[model samples]
Target: MRGGNTNGPDGNLRKDVETALLRPNLTPWQRTFLTDIHARLERSGGQARLSDKQWRKIFEILGRPNNVIALPPRTVTAYPPRRQPSKLFRPRFGWVGRRLRWRLRNLAIGFLIVAAVALGQQVFNLGRGQFQSTPTSTRALQTQEFSVTDGDTVHVVGEATGTRLVGFNTPEKFSPQCEYERQLGERASSRLRELVAHGSIQLTKVACACAPNTEGTSECNFGRSCGVLQVDGKDVGSILISEGLAVSFVCGRTSCPPAPRPWCKG
Candidate 1:
């Protein structure tokens, strides 16, 4: 047998109440009263759920009480009761969930990138000095050759070495003595770029304690190293020197070529 409330005075009263609520052009206060009464009746009657029509009427009244336009109402008479929606929220739950998921994915990717960079830096700093003391050092370096710094230097990293071309000097591109020197420096830098454009270069690390904007300095004003640059089994320094693009420089034994300057006395 179907278990239900017997149609007594209480059931008739409940039916009357629902009918009144479901009628058109209800006043704001009357609609609110009907909804409250409906909720109380269901609570007292062992939570016997209302029909979709009844639930839809209550929701419409509460959500858009001013709208006179009739719309299809949702069923409320669900057994065990459907989850009540938030009173103030619009119906965008699915879109909200999807957007939140998308942003969470981007956040995860960002965290992964940060973690990788940190790991790489730690690996780089482990006992492999960026600027080695001499070019002839037996220990090899871990670096990827990038671009030439000037006529006699190139930039590298994996351990971040600022390597200078050993055995020669080029015109001062970084800090030129005169217009002529700057012009020559640019030409020298161009040639150097061409020479190193071939392959995964044989990397070396040598420490040079050079000053900023100076080609070769023992004083070490900037973080740089003196290292031999080779491209395709050819020494870049020797090429520049022979081609007259650069002048010879020997460390701790012979001096660099005479500076071309207004400061140099004739």
Candidate 2:
């Protein structure tokens, strides 16, 4: 009834639709409503043709269905975080190399400290005249074997060794500090020569107090040997000290005090 126009007296169109609905290919709705629609058309004497709404429904049923493909929803998988490398996987010698370098550096520093101590000890021993060894055997000497150098020093005739008396020191004759000292030194030297010339001279060699590795060097009393001089079992040093010619010159293990010179005193 709501269509734009009504059909005319077209009995042929109604007969044609009836003929199509009777066919075997017709839908269930088309077949069931076919008799109803024909009876109505007969009642109206085919004055009303099929409406546009009924025709549109029949055409829609005859068309193809939608072609939508149904797929499952997208899935997202979660994985664990990336693992970091362990110490085992690192370079094998990296720690070893660092430790070895540290040890070597320490060893080098230790060596330098040891060397510095040794050098300092050597420097401290200088001019100290440290006592080394004492000889117990007495050596008897003839007049030709040695010659008196001064009041307390003697030179071996053929040997290059020089001897310094251990117990006493006289004023310097070769390098005197004053004229009176020179005169006293000459008298002391004359007295020593007279004592050694007449009596049985006994010389006992003693190791000079010197620094390590400096026994032959100039630091060791110019390479002079130390000795105790005795004539006829009497110590020459005692006789000289008692006669007011030389001063008592005692030495400790490492050093000796400057000899007290009476001749040079004002």
Q: Indicate which candidate wins on lDDT.
A: 2
Relative to the unseen true structure, what is the C-alpha lDDT of residue 250 in candidate 1, on a scale of 0 to 100?
66
Q: Write the per-residue lDDT of candidate 1 for residues 138-187, one digit (tens) a residue.
A: 33322333556578766554223346667777886434545566677779
Taken over the whole model, the C-alpha lDDT of each candidate is 0.56, 0.67
Off by over 4 Å in 1: 1-144, 158-161, 207-221, 253-266
lDDT of 2 by residue, 26-66 (tens): 64545655555567667777654343223333333334232
Worst 10 residues of 2 by lDDT: 1-10
Per-model tally of clashing residue pairs = 12, 2
Model 2 residue 178 CA deviation (Å) reads: 1.1
